[model samples]
Target: MLNIADTLYRWCREARPFALATVIEVSGSAPLPPGTALAVDTDGNAVGSISGGCVEGAVYELCEQVLESDETPVRASFGYSDDDAFAVGLTCGGELTVLVQRIDPTDQPHLANTLEQASDGVPLSVAQVVDGPPRLVGRTLSVLGGGSAYDGTLGSRRTDHTVADRVRALLRAGRTARVEVGGDADTCPEKLTLLVHTQAPQPRMLIFGAVDFAAALSQAGHFLGYRVTVCDARPVFATAERFPHADEVVADWPHRYLESAEVDARTVICVLTHDAKFDIPLLRSALGLPVGYVGAMGSRRTHEHRLERLREAGVPAEHLARLRSPIGLDLGAHTAEETAISITAEIIAHTNRGTGLPLSRVPGPIHGRVPADEAPAPSELLAV
Candidate 1:
């Protein structure tokens, strides 16, 4: 499992065979999502988690059984049981289907290589066949991003091609998914099911300004698992001492640095430089990107002026609408630290499509499943 890739990889290299248990499906409320894995080495040692803590002991024992078995993958289902408190079950009234399999990394070097890549922070996806053809169970297919070739196979070239194509789609979206591929008469089953786990670098949080708000927001962004960067033209204020939480601080023109920075659909750009000289050009570039969120800090009057300037710079009306000027939900924030909380709350609310109203005012379950695009956990998030 990528969650314990570093530990598992070390175990494999040490010639210790281990059992890997991964949650393949979930029904009802689950604290941890599918692809959450728990692995146990030969010596009763365990790493990672299938549940936060509710079912770790049960899953750990499952891993032990898997290791003692005939090296065949099996499915273990856990569900909430109102009848017995001692039963192995989830307390959140959810059901999970975990697939357990044993691996000898020396024989199956594909897993070793995948874990190595994950430890090194490479963008890739590893899909393991958990169902369908009995013989093909545990077969793996891994594909690296950036139009590179895939390694390993699902028994035949056809199956490999079919799974690899779909894996690319999930890899591009950086999602963990359970998918069933259609039958292949040769070297395949009627339906081959897999758990595809994607691993990518941390999403970027570009905070444009070196003020107190940017510094406080950098801590919030970092706590949320984003790679935060603070940029400003003033080198004196942009020093690492000023923005210690930011992963990097750049003393460059905001627009010039953003043009050169590597960003993707998961990036979030925050403009805290209220000055028109910097805000105008920087926003012109950020709003055009397909990043996750774009917000600027300013008053209502300043927001109106910013819109006028962006319009003069020839930004389209549609792109202009994408900006969340006077950024953040109305949280009655006064201090910079409080404003950082308000702004980060807006970023999350936008990503989750929340209405910024009290949960009691909203209707529906408190815990709901969001699509991968709407809520993607960091690929590198540690489950331990």
Candidate 2:
């Protein structure tokens, strides 16, 4: 399949007017993820972000030039340390680069064809920067048909095909790798460079039992950019009006609801139904799945009781050990809103293999939430 980034680049190219921004580098803590992008128009409208609210205004100016000149793609850097850098600065002190390319009719044929493939749900790579040194920095590869085929360049046909095959494996398995190429004659690192990175879709959060807390949890999940699904046996409680922000509200037994779900290591299942009638069946259903986070909300006493019932239901002792009973990190969360934050925080920590500590202590991919929807249609994008 065409990676989301390639599809986005195509969308900008097809739009009447647009500019593309990419985070080419990073240092220190950053609010925006590397490979983050924002497509802008002549009027300073934008669809994505490179930083948490910093550098956008300046990026817009570059975008305006792209729209006006319609010339070669512009490589612009936004750094806190650059004396000539624009006035905008990241609150967290991280630096990034944004390449703004103005799309024109000359960019039409190739871009339009690629966008049509993307709209048809076919993914492929396109040559992004030509005439530059044959370095990995300028070479971009696109994967189509869900990584079945690759287009564009990673220096040479040999390098592109080789890295494409390996990256394709990682994409299917939903993992990222840091590949080194062309150092030696057999595996030379001097002739060519290729570092294939893939940003899989955002993980899902399936929350059972649409109680008052469900609304709060849905909001929390939204903040974390999870495709939140709220399911309950009662249709009355599971209305979209109650949890309007939820990506989906299903009126089905929690156990049966997840049977049709595409659960994976990226998926999280949280059981908020403290009653046995719900918890027992729910736990039974989840035990067979490969979900990364399986948490149940209850007290220590309730957890013990539920464990006994789960054991009676034949859930393996090893599987039962995976449950995070008395769910959520210890944040002294008493209210529904605070409790929701704590639960979502635990899910984040679980997914990242992170300790439940302040994010400031960690030095890793901070903005990890991938936009699940294909890069928003130009109209769907927001102003910077």
Which one is best on TM-score?
Answer: 1
lDDT of 1 by residue, 228-269 (tens): 999999999999998889999999999999999998766889
Model 1 backbone overlap count = 0
Cα lDDT tens digits, model 2, 105-149, are 243434555555655644233433322343344445655555556
lDDT of 2: 0.66
Worst 10 residues of 1 by lDDT: 375-384
Each model's lDDT comes to: 0.82, 0.66
Clashing pairs in model 1, backbone N/Cα/C closer than 3 A? none
For model 2, the stretches where C-alpha displacement exceeds 4 angstroms are 1-136, 139-202, 359-384
For model 1 the local lDDT of residue 160 reads 73
Q: Residue 103 in candidate 2 has what lDDT? A: 57
Model 2 lowest lDDT segment of ten: 367-376
Candidate 2 positional error at 95, Å: 22
Off by over 4 Å in 1: 145-147, 184-190, 201-255, 263-384
